[model samples]
Target: MVEEVERRKKEILKAIIHEHIFTAEPVGSRTLAKSYELGVSSATIRNEMSDLEELGYLEQPYTSAGRIPSDKAYRFYVDTLINDRENLNLELIKLLNNFNYERQGIQQIMSNMAKMLSSVTRYTSVVSEPQMKKSRIKQIQLIPVEGKRILIVLITNTGIVHNKIVKLKQDLNPRQLGYLNEYLFNNLKDKRIKGINNLVLQELEKRLIKRLDLSQEIIELVYKGLEMVSKEDDFKIYLGGTSYILEQPEFNDLDNLKKVLNILDHEEMLKDLLVTIPNKELEVMIGHENKIEEMKKCSLVFASYTVGDMASGKIGVIGPTRMEYSRVIASVNTVAELMGKIISELSG
Candidate 1:
């Protein structure tokens, strides 16, 4: 009997979610019976709705009204109703084709795509640009310029090239800089060195200790090159339509608004939370499903975007659980797919 009631409870919850998604209104028992074609009486649905309310799936905003889904209920609905990538391939192709399909830089692609997503979904959209932290180094060049300065250029296999200038103890000639460049490439080529900073300098020092002439200057140049790389390796998050939330009644509370803004202000946390490397099509972390207090009141929809079939980028949407899952999830999936495509074309 408990299992039977539980199944019917899910059925009622599904009906409520569908109705609420379309109407954006709390679902009363009578409305559910008439609109959902549930083949159940309003009295029966009301009783089951009451039971579901007890189970923490539904809530009544006021004494005299119908039930709205709690965050818990929204989680269940997203987990069940949104697992499959429905009509995603066809819609994704359509949306991608609508774009010029040219090789726009990843940043431009994300910004425009985020705008499009925000326009369609009317929710806050965040697109993380393709980060090359995990990519391996392809080559390093030390070019001798004038006035005791040498330019260190590091190129990654993924077509990202970064350069920095370091003042040398002695202004080396082009021949010496060329030798150093070749040596660094011989040692560091194909190495994943985005995280390698001063520690890498120390290691290179130990390796080149025998060649006292090359050790100090090479390490200094490498240090400066790494500083440039670190600066470039930082994530870029483009957030569109934060103001859209102000229009929603739920964010009317000043305190809640502050919390949301704080979360948005810490763009690094957003990158860290959403840009993890996971083989997931869509990631939905519900209220309290997140690790932070600010996010406890909301939900995040994230998906990883790959660059050139190798490197991973991230794109997502953030909004209340009442967010239209089918539509927003579709938009997120489509944007993530395009982010990957754009990065692949640009990087290739």
Candidate 2:
């Protein structure tokens, strides 16, 4: 009997959530009891809904006749109700296939994916180039600019390049820098440069020190500069539909709008938000489930796009907590996967 009551309550809750998502309005117990055919009276559904409200699953605003799903309820609905393994709709699959993305670069793919998501979900979308740490070195070009500075150009598999100057204590002539460039190209080109250490630097140091008067300090400086270059490569976040949030009822408060924009301005924080879960698969953060205080009023769904073994990136959508989880999750996952495939094809 307890199990039966629990199952019926779940059904009623799901119906309410579904209806609310569709209408963006509060759901009345009588409506669910009558239209959803819960096989129960309005009185009984009202009792159950009152209990759900008490349990933090539903909220009744201003003594209203209808109820809406609370953050906790949305969390429960998303976690237990969603079946991610289910194949996407055939129309959705066909739409994804029609993108003509085979030869497109990762940037265009991400931009297209964002636009697609916004069009379908009526929400803002942001796509980040795969995070830099997960990417491998595709090529390194050391260009001699002056006697003391060399422009170090690092290319990753994600079609992005990072350039920095390595300041040397000693002036290195073009010929010497040319030999150094050759050494870098021969040994380090196409190598994953993230795990470089003292021993690796020592080996290169021994070889180069004998050939030139370059100090260990200068060699280590170049190596450290490259490390900073790699971390900076993690993301170039492009945001769209930011104005859409302002149009939502939840963000009508000017202060909340300012807070949300302030949070988005911190790129590293956004990276942390996207990458903290550490899953290559799609993940959803709804309402209060987000650790950031400003984000508590919204929901975020994103996925990490891998670029070979060298790097991974993120693509995600941000909207009010009332977002359609199934649709957003599916679309975001599709975009991330397509972006990854495009990146791989580009580097290959």
Candidate 3:
């Protein structure tokens, strides 16, 4: 008898969640009794909903009204009810498999991934570049562009290329520049980009200045180029389907919409938020689970993707707390895994 009651409660909760996901409306007992084959009367379903609400799985937004699944209910559904082996959309899988990572760069790939996710999930998508702190330098070249300017080209193990222009106070001849390039390549080779900080640059400058009898101006130019390459902003973010958020009922309020727009505008904050999640596993932050104040009313589904062997990045979708968790979770996991595989292949 106890087992039967538990089964009935699960059925009712699943039906409510499914209805709420599509309609974005509160689910009533009558709706469940009519739509779902729960083998119970409206009164019995109402009593079960009351019990579920009292137990914290469902919440009534108003008096004498229908109920909506709370964060707890969503969590229960994701953990216990969702099928882990849900197949990826076949069309999306074909698109992913056909992607040409050789011709298209990583940035383009990330942008397309974000766009694909948004289009499929109908939610805002955010994809970040691989963190450079863990990526080792594969090559460094200093090419003289013109008088008093040089182009510093850096390639990382993850196949990311960074180029910067540095102005030198005094110009150095091609021979001197060649020696400097070789020195930089030898010093930075195999060193993590983030590990090359100002201190390291200063040390390199001091050594080059003393050993080669180079002018302080030329050494400072090299240091400046290295500094630009190692900055935290080396990692970039790409966003897609931002307009989709406006379609959700939760963002119908002007103030709520504005808050989300503001949060999206600040790319650094979004990058920080994605990285601070200690776990690289697929994670769902519902409602108040988000630390950012603007996201308290929203839900975030995110997962990490690897580049090469060491470097990794994050990809996620943001929508109202009433999001379809099963679909969002499956979509995020599939995209993240495909992205990691493509990146690994390209980097190799």
Candidate 4:
């Protein structure tokens, strides 16, 4: 069983982690005594460090050298010692870019958000596309341009619009187009994409097949296009500042650097780094706690954002284990709240 750390030991542990995070080097007792106002001699601080090491909070990397904080030490520091992070808010807001959300699509907004996070935090940023589970069909329009060509616009209640152009073998007359529009609106309007199944598919097919005056081939093509736009993207992960993490001193090793880069290069694996829980606000995963083998040497800070009650998305920063917890945490919180508010307003 692990024993509780005393007040002085906790203070010493916090100091070591702070020094190591700043300099990326092993923290020795003499340096702590000289720099920090610990009110103790070097010998006393050294003794406390020894006890802290024995208790598994600190580890020595070399023989007769300074010690570094272990994963346990980092976890303790993040959970207990973090202070007011308001000083960095102004800088973060500027980097986040106060723009017109109503004019931008979700894709552009998310891409900009990823870049913003990386620029501010100097770490790799990953932002997931907003989930659209409850987004229902708002309206559908078919506009004719020229010979045998038409434009289809599918708008979702969540403010997502999809446009497609198709060439039909036969031109659709205005009367036929009006009838088809009414039929589509009566049957599919306000229907959730998730609820579209085989039963619904059979009914749509059966009714369309019975319409002998309409072109079956054109309806088939239209169905294909509509289905494509209605579904959600398969794990779309927007990545930014991927090379920034490589610049960290901890990723100096070539082998370790390659492993981390591989994870970032692939979306299937990167998607696992950001998972959104509906109501939970924020999460910080340190070292092995992240549960991904290639990412065990890194840390991930995640914040969940939602589009009103329809769907939720995620944004995060990936950096070395010795991360600036206070700044990163505050930044993620700020961005998540700002993003959720803008998206909700647009959707509403």
Candidates in order: C-alpha RMSD to true structure: 3.7, 2.7, 2.4, 4.1
For candidate 3, the lDDT comes to 0.85
Best by lDDT: 3
**Which residue pairs in candidate 1 have backbone atoms (N, alpha carbon, C) closer than 3 angstroms, thus clashing?**
none
Give a tens-digit lDDT track for model 1, residues 1-348. Answer: 889877788889998987876666789999988877777799999999988999899988887668898888988998775554564445445656788746665457678888777766777888765565666677787777788777777776555566778777776656656666676789888776665666776777676656545646556665666666646335568888888878666677888888888878887767656644254767888777877777776778888777655545667777876777877777788787767766666656
For model 4, the run of ten residues with the poorest summed lDDT: 271-280
Instruction: Give Cα distance to truth, residue 306, candidate 1, Å.
Output: 2.4
Clashing pairs in 3: none
Better of 2 and 3 by lDDT: 3
Residues 1-348 of candidate 4: C-alpha lDDT, one tens digit per residue: 134337778788889998998899999988999999988889988999999899899999888659998888888888988862644666677766666566788778888888888888889988886654456777888788797888878776656666778788898888878877778877888888678665886688679768737767888777766666665553367888998977899899988899899989888667655542223677888888877788888888888877765446788889998888888888888887777887778766
By descending TM-score, how would the candidates be arranged?
3, 2, 1, 4
Write the number of the candidate with greater TM-score, choosing between 2 and 4. 2
Model 2, 298: alpha-carbon shift in Å?
1.2
lDDT of 3 at 326: 77
Cα-based lDDT for every prediction: 0.73, 0.77, 0.85, 0.78
Question: Which stretches of candidate 1 lie above 4 Å from their native place?
Answer: 1-5, 87-93, 101-103, 139-153, 160-176, 194-203, 206-221, 224-233, 275-279, 308-311
Report the C-alpha displacement of residue 72, candidate 1, in angstroms: 1.5
Candidate 3 weakest lDDT stretch, 10 residues: 272-281
Report the number of the highest-TM-score candidate. 3
Residue 192 in candidate 3, Cα distance off native in Å = 2.7
- Please give the lDDT score for candidate 4: 0.78
